[model samples]
Target: MHIPDGFLDAKTWITTTAAGAGAVAYSLRQAKLALEPKRVPLIALVGAFVFAAQMINFPIAGATSGHFLGGTMVSILFGPWIGALVMTAVLLVQAVVYQDGGITALGANVLCTGFIGCFVGYGSYMLGMKLFRGKGRAIVAWMSAWLSIVAASAGVAVLLAASGTFNLATALTAMVGWHMLIGIGEGMITMLVTGYLMERNAVMTGGGFKNERLSRNRA
Candidate 1:
């Protein structure tokens, strides 16, 4: 969900930019450690796939077209940090060349869709994996994506409230309500794509998958 430039005021834009910068910096450092040589190509391909998938949008409840956010899917396949980085890149390109999103509102979009979405989805998936002893992967995936979308919507709601675009109650109700419906779409896409694309042997590093290239790190 990319917020247009005029949607957020200057103060909200500045605040979100600072937060997005910090998150992107942290994610970059973590990505350097998490990604292995063999995994680089795969990660790039997955990012491209996510980018492409996002272009195909279906109509939602309020005449707004919702598409695959792909944050949860990426985070589950890779990790939160890498997933964040990938989304940031996607958003950057969309803003710069494609004009899908606004440059001034880029930071807000990144904070909501990139950082919030990736971390929430990945964190919940890891927790679910632990809770279920890794049995119900599909369920965990679905839930994680569902939660991530809602969380991102919440982030947007908070920002809108802060910007005085709407009162907290109204913004919260509108954003969360729309996203609850949107999240069903998100969950379905995340589960289906994750099941189809993420290979079992794909290395998961720097989040919860400790088995990933431990020897390489030592070396």
Candidate 2:
């Protein structure tokens, strides 16, 4: 859900911009510390994949479009900080080069789809893994991905409501409703991709990902 220009009021956009900027700044620091130099290529590959996935959107509510958000899967493979960076990069390219999303609303879009998506998705995945005692991994991944999409869509709805673009209830119903269906694809993709990556011992498997989990648990 890439919010377009003029959709959000100045106050709403400015507030979201500040919050989103702060999140990204923190993410950069955390990612630098957590990320391995060797995984840079993997990050680039995932970022490209996410950008391509977002490019193919299906119509939703006659107002917006829905697509697979790779945040959950990426976070599982690399961790939240790097996942956020990947999403931010994709959003920036789409906004500047393709004009797919508005520049003014970039911060808002990032807050909802990048920051919110990454953290919520990551958190949910971790929690699910914990709750299930590390069993039913595929199911956990699917549920986490689904929840992440719903949470991100809800964030977008709240921003729209604050902007007076639509009332809170209406915005929530419309955005979340359409997103629930889209989330199915999001869930399946996240489950299969994460499973494959882990099985193949790809990317952050033993290094960054394990460290990320350890740090998170200690926290």
How would you encode candidate 2's per-residue C-alpha lDDT over 71-179 as one tens digit per residue? 8888888888988989889888999999987988999988888988888999998888879867899999999899899999999999999998779999999888988
Alpha-carbon lDDT of model 1: 0.86
- For candidate 2, what is the TM-score? 0.88
Candidate 2 lDDT for residue 23? 90
Model 2 residue 64 CA deviation in Å: 8.2
lDDT of prediction 2: 0.85
Instruction: Give the TM-score of each candidate.
Output: 0.90, 0.88
Candidate 2: pairs in clash: none
lDDT for each candidate structure: 0.86, 0.85
The superposed Cα distance between candidate 2 and the true structure at residue 211, in angstroms, equals 7.8
